[model samples]
Target: MNPFLIPRRPWTRQCMLPLGARPGLGTAAGNWQRLQEAAGGLPVPGPATLGNQPRLSGDAACCRVTPRLDRPKPLVFSAMWVWALLPILLVLWGTVGFWLVYAMAVANGSVNVTVVFPYISTCGSDPPQSCIFGQVMNVGSFLVVWISYLRFQQVRDWGCPCALNTAGLVLGLLCALGASVVANFQQNNQLETHLFGVFLAFVVGIVYFWVQAALTQQVKPRHGGGWLGPARFCLCATGTALLVAMCALHGLGLKSEAAICEWALTQSLFLLFGLFAEDFRHIESCCVRLQGRAPSPALELGAASTQTLAL
Candidate 1:
């Protein structure tokens, strides 16, 4: 979620310290400015000690400290931000790019993406959508795998199961490798290898979703509801089932039906990723924040004692 939209505590008037009318001993010579401090200066007050400290003849001595009114920020490290956006961005980019290329390729009725399209890998052989298709697939698949690995660590951080996380991470990597292979070896170049890569990508992708769905359910109860849990499983199942049906139809010489099934299958897999995006978002390694813990009880007591030192 965007930090700004997370219902954070704005610098409220109630939370701010009142301006003081008296100067402290530390004020400039003869200035006696209300905002100035006395020469002796105010005693140093920690957040917790503010309420208990004796009021001194210094600026804003009666001002109270404010307590944080929001949940403590997570301790995300520098490298974690990479884990957040890469996978999501790559998949979206690839999907959009592929469609753009497909539209261009089919614009003049030069190629039919529905039936004659053996697979996405062979799209490179067509005009207007050549090598770019494979490049997008390769990049997207690589990021997907990396994201899965990062998700494994993220789930672990969320106190999820180790074995399942490991399995999901590994399968995700396998899926990426398969996709990369397909991109590297197009149907015309090496049909067997291309077919194998497609098979590997789909099969491993299904298992990856299965593990990810389980891990998502183990997230802290405070986070959110398990709204996507059943949907995640169903999406994975739908993709896998479509893949099977698409293959069977293709083998039985129903090329057009197979193409539609294949297209829907890919969409289903994409939807599967989207289902758990909310669940794993908090653990993203990218752009993570490091924040201080919640103020202690003493600090709460000092809420009415800490004052704003400046306007």
Candidate 2:
């Protein structure tokens, strides 16, 4: 007999056997055969049972495990969109507030070339209302322009393109400084001080052009039938014309009425131009780019097509 096939028997024949096998005993051969036959018909454990256990299948393994990462929240994009619009709102507020207060000053005879220096120098003596309004307008304009420049920088995600914008902004601040100097001059020759103010104003105009050129590159232009583009152009042009007229009238010793009227018109144009430039540029660019075809040959003036070059 093969040793592997032989069963180890430590007990008597009364011991239980597995389902498929029968225990041997001293028995009649016919009875033993009958028992063996009965056991052979029962189910037997296969090779899967010897110290082996069931395992997860491939699909079951994948489903049972948790992912290492979680899904991100959806509000991030909406928050960024709101952050982008903040600069525009600030600029509009500053422009509008400055214009309203300036117009009031002009109407009340509180604003004039002759009084420009004295008004600035002796501002503390006047009601705090006038001084505060002037300071707020000046500071607000500076803050708005700075914010606008920063916004443009973020939108482009690029290095600074030109020094012209920086120069323009700095020149504007210098113009204000110049006005202060003219006011504090020991000799109270109103004419000389007024002339200096006019000179400073002209410098401010040059600064505007530089700033506009830089901004144009950063912003888009308005589309067809939109009044914003034309309005901006008209405002800037009218302001320029008025400034020239004011200077000419002053030089030619023209009547005060003409100077006052020109000054008022210039201020109005400046306010409108500053307030709408960014919006106009954005709208115009969107329209042009959406045309489906290249812009017309006549309109293809390099960066001019997008108003980026003009500013």
Top candidate by TM-score:
1
Alpha carbon deviation, residue 303, candidate 2 (Å): 53
For 1-311, candidate 2 gives per-residue lDDT tens digits of: 10111112221222222332322322223333443443344322322232232332221110111123343333322233343354455446545654555556555665565634222223222343345444554554454455445434433433444465556456656554543433333123355665575456455744564465445444443222355445556666666676667667757766464446454653553454355334433321211122256577677665333422110
For each candidate in turn, the TM-score is: 0.61, 0.41
Q: List the lowest-lDDT window of 10 residues for candidate 2.
A: 58-67
| Predicted model with the maximum lDDT | 1
Residue lDDT tens for model 1, 162-213: 8887888888889989888887787777889988988878887887887777
Q: What is each predicted model's overall lDDT from 0 to 1?
A: 0.63, 0.43
Worst 10 residues of 1 by lDDT: 1-10
Regions of candidate 1 where Cα sits further than 4 Å from its true position: 1-84, 108-110, 113-118, 220-224, 284-311
